[model samples]
Target: MKPNGWIIYNGNLPGNKFLDYAEMIQESATKQGIDMKILKNNALLSLLATDQLGIVQLDKAELPDFVVFADKDIYLARQLELLGITVFNSSKAIEISDDKIASYQYMATHNIPMPKTIVAPKIFTTGNIDHKLVEKAIEQLGLPLIIKEAFGSFGEQVYLLHSLEEIITKIDAIQGKPYLFQQFIPSSYGKDLRLQVVGNQVVAAMERVNINDFRANVTSGGAMSVYTPTKEEAALAVAATKAINADFAGVDLLIGPDDKRLVCEINSNAHIRNLLDCTGINAADYIMEHILGVLS
Candidate 1:
C-alpha cells in the first residue's frame, strides 16, 4: 500500500497561492505513487487539556503518516508532531525559518557568510527609543542600512533607510516588534538569488531583480530568470538548509563585493509557485523524491 501523507497550508490567507502550493506538492506526490491529502491549517483544531494534547479534526478523520507543513502556524505543526506524525520542515525548523532574527542568529553561529547584522534591542513600550542605539547601529553598518522585521514575508516589512530621520521614522512605526538592522549589500541591490534545496542538493535556482525597490521579492514586482548557481552557492544553500534542520528550503542569497554569495534568508515552507513559473522546474518533484527517499 502506498504511504499516506497530508499537505497542510494556512487557510486564513486570501486567494489561491497557498492552495496552489499544496496542489503542486500533491501532484508531485501522486506521480510518485504516494497517497496525499490537502488540509487547511484551520481544519485541525489543537485541543489541549492538562496531561493530554490532541486535535479535533473536522469529520474526525484518521491521521496521515506524514505531514508537509506549508503554514507558519508553529503551534499546530507542533501539535501534529505530538500526535506522532512526521512534519516536513518540522516545528523547530518552521519557527526558526519564520523569524529573521532567529534565522540570522542560527546562521551567524554556524559560520555562514552573510552581511553584518545587529539584533535590535528590545523595546518594552511604544515610548521613545534611545537615539544612541540607532547611532551605534549606523556606526557599525554605515549609511543606508537595512531594517527588517523578524516576522514578515514578501519583503513587505523590509526597509532601507538612508538617513537618521528615516531610521527614526521607521523605528517609531515598528513599535516593539522584534526586528534587526543589517548592513546594506551594494552589490546585491535590487537583486539576489533564490536556490530551492531538497535534501543535499540544489533542485532549482533563480535570480530576482527589481529596479523600483531595494527588496527583490516577486510580490514586490521583482523579475525572475532561471539561474545556474555556482558550486559555492550550492554548497552554501545546502549548508544553510542543514543548519536550520529543514528537509527542504528556499535559500535566498546575496552577491558580496567579490561576487561571492551571502546567506540572505531561508524559507522552510517556501512558496514554489514562483520557482515553478520561472524555472519550468517544479521543486515539488524534488521535494517529494527527497521525502520518500528519506522515509524509505
Candidate 2:
C-alpha cells in the first residue's frame, strides 16, 4: 500500500513561494506512486484538531504518516510531534535555526568555525546607549562588524557597522531587542554561498552575489548563480545542518580572506526556488522522498 503523506502549508493560499513548493511536492509524490495531500490551512489550528489528521479537507484530524512543514510554523510543528506524528526538520531544529545568535553559538561550540560573535544583553526600555559594550565589541572584533537581530530573515535586519559611530546609532535605534555583533568577513564581497542539505546530504549549492548591495538574500535583490562547492565546503554545510539536527535546511557560508569557510546561518524552512533555478535540481522531490521514507 502507498503511504499517505500530508504537507502543511500556510493558509494564505496560492501565490506564496511556500505553497508553490507544496504543489511541487504533490506532483513529485504522484509520480512516485504515493498518495500525497496538500492542505492549505492555518497550520497552528490544523494541528489542534485530532480528527483532521488524514482527512484532506476541512475539520478532520487523524495521525498522518508524515507531515512536511513548508512554513516556519514552529509552534504547530511541536504540537504535531506531541501527537506522535513524524515531522520533517523537527520543531527543536526549527527553533535553533530561527535564532541567529543560537545558530552561531551552536556552530561555534561544535567547532564549525563561525565568525566571532558577542550577544548583547536583552533590552527592556530604551535609554542611554551601551557605549562601553559597543566599544568593547569593536575593539575585539574590529571595524566593519555585522549586527543582526536575533530573529531575522531575508537579510531584513542585518547591518554592516563600518565604524563605532554607526554601531552606537543603530544600537540606540534598535533598543529592546537582543543583537549579535560579529566580525565582518570581507571576502564575501557581497556574495555568499547557500547550500541546500537534505537528510544529512548536500543536494545543491549556489553562490548568491549582491553587486549593488551588501546583503546576499535573493529577496534583497541579489543575483544567484550556480557554484560547485568543493568537497570541504559540501562537508561543512552538511555538518552544520546535522549539528542543528535539521532534516532539511539551507546553510549559508561566508568565505573569508584566507579562503577559510565560516558557517554563517541555517534556514530550517529553506526557500528552494533560487536553488532550483541555479542547480536545476528538484528539491521538492527530494523532500517528498524523505517524508515518504520516514512514513514507510
Candidate 3:
C-alpha cells in the first residue's frame, strides 16, 4: 500500500497561504502516488492524560504513517512523535528554528559563519529591561544593528536601528520578549540568497532584493530572481540545515565582507510557492521524495 501522511499547518493564521503550502505538498504527494491529508493544527488536539497520551481526533480519524509538520506547534509535534509517528523536521528542530536566539546559539556551536549576535537579557516584565545591557550590546555591535525577536516570521519583527536611542526604544518596547542584537552586514543590505535545501543538497535557490528596505524578505516587498549558488554557498546552506537536525529547510545566506556567505536564518517549514515561481523548481516534490525515502 502507498504510504499515507498528514500535512499540518496553522489554521488560525490570517491567510490562505498556510493552507496554500499544505496544498502544494498535497499536489506533490499526489504526483508521487502517496495518500496525503492536509490537517489544521487545531483539528486534532494533543491529548495529555495519565492513562492516554496521544492525539484526540474529534472525527475518529486514523493516524497516518508520517506527518509533514508545517506549523510551529512544537507540543503537537512532540505528541505525534511520542506515538511513534515520524514528523519531518522533527519537534526539536522546529523549536530551535522558531526562536531566533536558539537558532543562532545552535548554529554557533556548529561554527556556522553568521553575523555577530548578542542575546538580549530575558526580563519578566515588559519595559523593565536593563539599559546597561543595551549599552553593552551597542558597544560590542556598534551602530546600525539589527534587533530581532525570537518568535517572528516574514521579517515582521526585525528592526534595523542606526543609533543608541533607537535601539533603546526598540528594546524597551520588547523587553519581556526574547530578542537579540546583531551586527548588521552593510554589504548584504536589501539583498540575500534563499537556498531551499532538501535532504543533503540544495534543490532550489533564489535571490531576494528589496532596494527600499533593509530586509530582503519577499513579504517585505523584496523581488525574487533565479540564482545559482556557488559551491561555498551550497555547502554553508546544507551545513546550517544539518546543524539544526532538520530534514529539509530554507536557508537564507547573507553576503559578508569580501563576498563571503553568512547564515541569516533557517526555516524548517519554508514555503515553496515563491521558490517554485522564481526557479521553476518545486521544493514540495523534493520534500515528498525525502519523506518517502525516509519512510522506506
Candidate 4:
C-alpha cells in the first residue's frame, strides 16, 4: 500500500510561505502516487497523559505513516514520533537547526568547515550587556564581524558590526536572546551559494548576490541564479545536513579567502520557492522521492 503522509506547517505565521511549502510538497507527493495531506501545526494538540502520550485533533483524523514536518514545533514533532510516526528531519534535527548556537556546536563536533565563532554567554534579562566578553570576541574575531541570534530566519537577525560601540548597542538591544559572534568573511560579503541537499546528494544549487548588503539572503534583496557546485561544495553541503541529522536542508556556503568554502547556515525547513524560481527544480519532488525510499 502507498504510504500515508502529512505536511505539517505553521498556521500562526503571517504569510502564506509556510502553507506554500506544504502545498508544494503535497503536490509532489500526489505526483509520486502517495496519499498526502496538509496540516496546520496548531490544529494538533499534544497530549501528555499518565498512561498515554498522544496527539489530539478536533477532526479525529488517523495518524499517517510518516510526517513531513515543515514547521518548527519541536514538541508536536516529537509527540508524533512518540506515537511511532516517522518525522522527516526529526525533532532533534529541527531543534538543532532552529538554534544557530546549537547548529554551530554540532558542526564543530563534526569538524565541519565554518567561520571562527564564539557563543555569547546567556543573559537572564535585558540591559545586562557584557562589554568585556564582547571585547574579547572582537579581539579574537577582529573588526567588521558578524553577530547572529540563535533563532532567526531569512538573515533578519544577523548583523555586521564594524565598531565596539555598534556591537554593544546591537547586543544591548537584543539582550536576553541567545546569539553568537563570528569572523566576517569579507570575500563573501556580497555573494554566497545555497545548495539544497536531499538524502546524500545536492538536488539543486544557486548563487545569491546582494551588492547592497552584507547579507546575501534573497529576502534581503539578493539576486539568484542557477549555479553548479563543485564536488567539494556538494560534499560539504551534504555533510553539514548530516551533521545536524537532518534528512534534507538548504546549506549556505560563504566563499572564504583563497576560495575556501565555509558553512554559513543550514535551514532544516528551507523555503523552496526561490530555489524553484531560479533553478527550475522543485526540491519537493526530491524530498518526496527520498521519503518514499526511506519508507520502502
Q: Which candidate is the best by lDDT?
A: 4
Considering summed lDDT, which 10 consecutive residues are worst modelled in model 3?
122-131
Estimate the Cα RMSD of every predicted model relative to the unseen true structure. 1.0, 3.0, 1.0, 0.9
Give each model's whole-structure lDDT.
0.93, 0.82, 0.93, 0.95
The TM-score that candidate 4 achieves is 0.98
The sequence of per-residue lDDT tens digits that candidate 2 reaches over residues 1-296 is 77676787778745678877788878888889877677764733633454555323455655577777776678777877876777787888988998888888788778897888999888775567778888999988999999999988888889998988999889888888878898888888688999988886788889988998777889988888888988999999989998888888999999887899988889988888778888999887888777666666
Q: Compared with the true structure, what per-residue lDDT tens digits does model 1 show for residues 184-213?
A: 999999999999999999999999999998
Clashes by residue pair, model 4: none
Candidate 4: where are CA atoms >4 Å away?
A: none
Instruction: Name the better of 2 and 4 by lDDT.
Output: 4
TM-score of each: 0.98, 0.91, 0.98, 0.98
Q: On a 0 to 100 scale, what is the lDDT of residue 166 in model 2?
A: 92
Q: For model 4, how does the per-residue alpha-carbon lDDT over 37-153 read when each residue is reduced to its tens digit?
A: 888998999999799899889667889999999999999999999999999989999999999999999999999999999999888774578679988999999999999999999
For model 3, residues 6-54, the per-residue Cα lDDT tens digits are 9999988997989999999999999989988888899889888889988
- The better candidate by TM-score, 2 or 4, is 4
The window of 10 residues in a row where model 4 has the poorest summed lDDT is 122-131
